[model samples]
Target: MSGDDSLRAVFARHRVRLLLAVVLLLLTMLAGVGLLGLSGGFLTAAALAGALGAGTTFNFFSPSAGIRALTFVRIVSRYFEKLVGHDATLRIARDLRVWFFRRALPLAPARLGGTRTGELLARLMSDIGEVDGLLVRAVGPLLALAGIALASIAVAAAIHWPAAVALLLLLLLIGIGVPLLAVHSGDAGEAERARHRTRLRTLAYEGLEGAADLAALDARDAWRARVDGAARQLAGDDHRRRGRLIAGNVLHSACAGLGLLAMLWLALSAFQDGRVTAPLAAALVFLTVALLEVAAGCGLAWQALQSARISAGRLQAIVEQPPSVSDPAHPRPVPASPATLSFEQVVFAWPGESRRVLDGIDLQIRPGERIAIGGDSGCGKTTLSALLLRLWDPQAGAVRWGGVDLREVAQDDWHRHVAWLPQGAPVFAGSIADNLRLGQPQADEARLWAVLEQVRLGDWARRQGGLSAWVGENGATMSAGQARRLAMARALLRDAPLMVLDEPTEGLDVDTAEALLVDMAAALGPRSLLMITHGHLPDGVVHRQYRLQRGRLLEVGGEAQG
Candidate 1:
């Protein structure tokens, strides 16, 4: 869908809430008008009695009672209006966030690869905040203000047509003209605000990531200065935007005051000329003042709308990015027992890179074959593994599993059938059991322990509370070797038909790495293995090896000669 359409759809989702808020606001406004009418009626009766030279002692009591009752009713309606409007806005904000994030997930590690972590964080938090203000604070209040303004003008027209015209002009000035002026003056302020937030977040993230380096270099003062500079820029932007906001408020208030004076003056003249009575004039004046509050809300709401527009634009950019890999409209069902994997003349490159990472590559692994891929660091070994898992689509070829194109299979289905131990495998902050469950959530304690033993981590697991030990944040408490072993155990527990191991023993000691591989190979027994590494192969472990260079695959030793 187009970006405009997507944004419109987002707004449409809140249609029900928007309608409810409008309806409630209208009812509240009408109640306000009814109160105005009641006060006017009591005043009119008192004035008529005085004009006729009759006693008017009871007039004060009647108008006071009506004013008190109306005041109570207005308060209750206003409270409910706020309650429902805010609740609705929060719901819309939640839905938009969920929708944006869900669309973002599949495109990530590819489309999102180039986006900075801090920038993404800012979009997720600050940009989303703008959307909330747009939907709830801006729309609801504007709608309410419009409703009240129209109602007030209509009522005033019945009392005095000229006065009604004056009030309507004031409404236009406060509700529309002043806001437009503010928007014109603050043309790029919202975008600037979003940009500043993104920059600040990026700097903060960099500072945190390089805190150790800065300390080592004794550059703390420089870093602090940088942070302080960003803060000052942010403050400056805020100051300018708020200055415009204050100007808009001042203009709106001035307009409202002029409108109230015109209404009151007209009413007094009508009363003296016998065109209206005293009580009605008093009520009209009070209603005009109350309506001013709604006009003030209108000005604020306009500013919020402008801010939200910028926020939604940022969020929309993320949501509308075409997925690098998307599911087919009609996906083929994956086989229950696939036998082989193949890559046919596959050419791939990282986005924007001149050279193909994997050029015209062709390979096939028969069912249950143990294949090792040996290559230099930049020869695209990990990239090939990622393709096999369909993290990214090859630019000029296809990867097929069990004779079915990988693209044809559902992503979750493909992931389910293949287990992976990535290069620099991630160790999440959690217990061993918690980590293991990621591979197979239903795996029992016995199964978990068995996998740990298979990877030579069973001893470590035993010493560290077995499955229940805390790994600390990002496995910070664990040694590099221990973290690698734990990751291996987690991958092994998957028990899938295919396993792709990417430099799984890169950081291990010789003996530990050797022992772990021996045990892993035995446990993996006939499952198809595609292992990528530069390390020497253990004896009798790998049945075949392929060397990758310049995007070309060449078989080594016995396989090619045969």
Candidate 2:
């Protein structure tokens, strides 16, 4: 679907609310026009009646009552219009975020390889926010203009056809022509504005997020320069867009002035021909000016629409992006018991890469067995784990769980049978228990402490206020070793049959790394284990060890580097 269609789909959930807002806006505008027209006619008729003194009578009560009624309607409807319109817009904004997350989650680490977190953040917050403004800025104003135009033309016609024709032409020019011209004029910068805005947000977030590292590395100035450049470009885009918006507003104002002048000339000619009275002519002039004011807002609405369109396109790019891997249409369930993993002559290459990361590899890990594989940097040691986790299927061979092809099984079902501790696992900004509970949400206090104790974090947790203690963003509050251990604890909390530890002890000292590896091995009572690392393996931790060479695994007779 196109971006426009996608955006429509996003708002479809709140369509009823949006329709109600539009109705309120139309009623509000009509009331304003009526109030102005009645007040003008009443004052003029009263003045003329007073000039005739006791010889003439004016019906003050009825017109005065009508003015009061329109005044009340205008005020009340305008208030409700704002309330309903903003409520509906906020609802759509909330849902848009949820919708984007649902669509983007399945594509992670694979199809999302090219996307940065900051860029995604900007899309989620800023772009989606601009879309939310569509209801108030674009939709409401257009509906109001339409209602005001019809009412104003009818009133003008009652006075004189020439006056009515002039009002109609003016409304059409301001409502349609001027706004369309502004929209098209702003179109060139709308997309660029969105891009630069996202880029600015991305750079700002990156700079703030990595401020410490940049300062320590003496790279703060360089990063700031880039951020400044992004800011300048974004400012330029905004300037161009503002220029068009201002130009459109000026054009509409000029047209409204000219429209009033034309309406007055027509009214005067009608009065001279005895078709319109002096009081009625004055009323028509006031009504014409009010109508012009209502229609003039169309230019601003058009500019808002242009901005919203660009935001919709940015949001659509992620919501419509294809996942790197899709689950089978008809999937089988994984084994109920402990699953035995096997790789049969698996060969693989990353998407768009020519060199094979893994080639003709065969291996197995049965229930209650421990195995470790070592490899140099960039030798696809982690690639093997990704295939095992079904993050990406092998290009050549099938990875089986309990003799069944992994692809045939539902991804979620397969995930339930295994626990994986990826290298450099992130620690979310939350309570210690909150982060750990992600692995197993139902884990009780005793269970959490037990897992923490296993990873040597139990004492630290107690000292810091136990499970309720906060872990800063990405575990910034903890030492590197503590963060690694906390991540391991999270992985260990999962009661799965198979566990894959990819450099689980990274960031710890050699002695601590070895001890952590030994602790990890001892913690696996019945579950099968596959530890992938470039470091030395702990003695007796695994039943077998292998070395990953160029696209192949070579069996080693003894222990490798820790």
Best by lDDT: 2
- Of candidate 2, the 10-residue stretch with the lowest lDDT total is 1-10
The deviation in Å at residue 155 for candidate 1 is 1.3
Tens digit of per-residue lDDT, candidate 2, span 210-231? 8989999999999989989999
lDDT on C-alpha atoms for all candidate structures? 0.81, 0.85
TM-score of each: 0.88, 0.95
Highest TM-score model number: 2
Name the lDDT value of residue 261 in candidate 2.
84
In model 2, the runs with Cα more than 4 Å from the true position are 1-7, 558-562
